[model samples]
Target: MKETSEKKAIIKKLMKEGKTYKQISEETGIHPGTVGIYGGKLKKAEREKKCFNGDRHLCKTCKYRASGARSGCDYIIHTGNERGCNPEVCNKYERGNRNETKTSSKGK
Candidate 1:
């Protein structure tokens, strides 16, 4: 088994490169679940460092935010390809109902 420090270093490098938890698990031979803990720790540390830099909206204005259903001004917005927009900053942002259809069914 890799030492704690070594595992942390590997996880940090993979995260910096934007590798997913699954990818990190595959490359590091660590379990997928454990990868979450590792990644979370790395993210926390990064957030702390960045926090000192200023509240540079990591999710609100992130270019990586997806363009569709999953779009919302939250950290999870960047988790996938779904587009997100912050209602507070984005005039185009709309509050969607979970059961609402994207298209009208009047003709159906």
Candidate 2:
């Protein structure tokens, strides 16, 4: 109970400090696999939050925007092996439907 929370806190803190799973495991005596699991969860949560909150555009021109992607920017996400144009991928493409909803709601 208390020990579990403590371990989670330690893992999160170490992860925020840019420590790798192996390094965290070595320092905290937690298994590398366990550290990696927690790290993966944290990273997933962070990505979701970033996407939902919107992010800055990485480039002046985005391939996803140019190609008329509606769901969201898939510049790097949909790429199987080919490298994307911008080194940093952005998740802030304004979906047409979502924009319409926003505009309609504002009128009400």
Candidate 3:
């Protein structure tokens, strides 16, 4: 795996600056749950590299990949609507939703 020192540094800096995960996520365009996951805030049951499965096709059926929505897709959230997830490079890709209903775009 490639080193994520830069992203880790940013997360640590944001936390040091007293920025909440929501703030960091908005600033970096990373999904908030990912922020929590990497920051050691949210504990996951079966953790793996988000995109290690190597199947962009899976995104079509992913709960996180909502279609025609105004916002909230992982791809749209990070790289805007112009691009779709590149399974080869997207370590942050996820195939499912968090284990709860989200009332807003911001993650818990």
Candidate 4:
């Protein structure tokens, strides 16, 4: 049997390649739910690493951050909400959606 670290490495690599949870589970003999849990944790860690401002709430490093505006970020104007940043309109969200489409089509 492969070690836990080796399994996690394989899972992360497969995920990065846009593989689905079911595909990863079949290849690694791990449960789909477990694969999803691991992937979620890895994604969170990667997001933290990508956040240059160090604070998720503050938009200091975000490109859409407003310059001396009362609302703070451009996301509010775009979405008409006070959520600061909306992942729905974020580039990262779009990229993830594209990857999901590819993976789903491949699975089918």
Better of 1 and 4 by lDDT: 4
How close to the true structure is residue 78 of candidate 1, measured as C-alpha lDDT? Answer: 30
Over the stretch 28-95, how does candidate 3's per-residue lDDT look in tens digits? Answer: 97778878877773222122344454445555555555546543345544444544435434444455
Clash pairs, candidate 1, are: 66-82, 66-83, 67-83, 68-83, 71-83, 71-84, 72-84
Which prediction has more favorable lDDT, 2 or 4?
4
Q: Estimate each model's TM-score.
A: 0.46, 0.47, 0.34, 0.48
What Cα-based lDDT does every candidate model obtain? 0.61, 0.60, 0.59, 0.63
Worst 10 residues of 2 by lDDT: 96-105
lDDT of 2: 0.60
Across residues 1-108, which tens digit of lDDT does each residue of candidate 2 receive?
338678888999999999989999999998888888888887877865665332333333444333344543444443443443332344444344322322233645
Alpha carbon deviation, residue 31, candidate 4 (Å): 1.6
Give the alpha carbon lDDT tens digit for every residue of 1-23 in model 1.
Answer: 98878988888888889999999
TM-score of model 3 (CA atoms): 0.34
- Cα lDDT for residue 27, candidate 3: 97
Model 4 lDDT tens row, 9-29: 989999999999899999889
Q: Best candidate, lDDT-wise?
A: 4
Q: How far is each candidate from the true structure, as Cα RMSD in Å?
A: 10.6, 10.7, 17.1, 16.4
Evaluated against the true structure, the overall lDDT of model 1 is: 0.61
Clashing pairs in 4: none
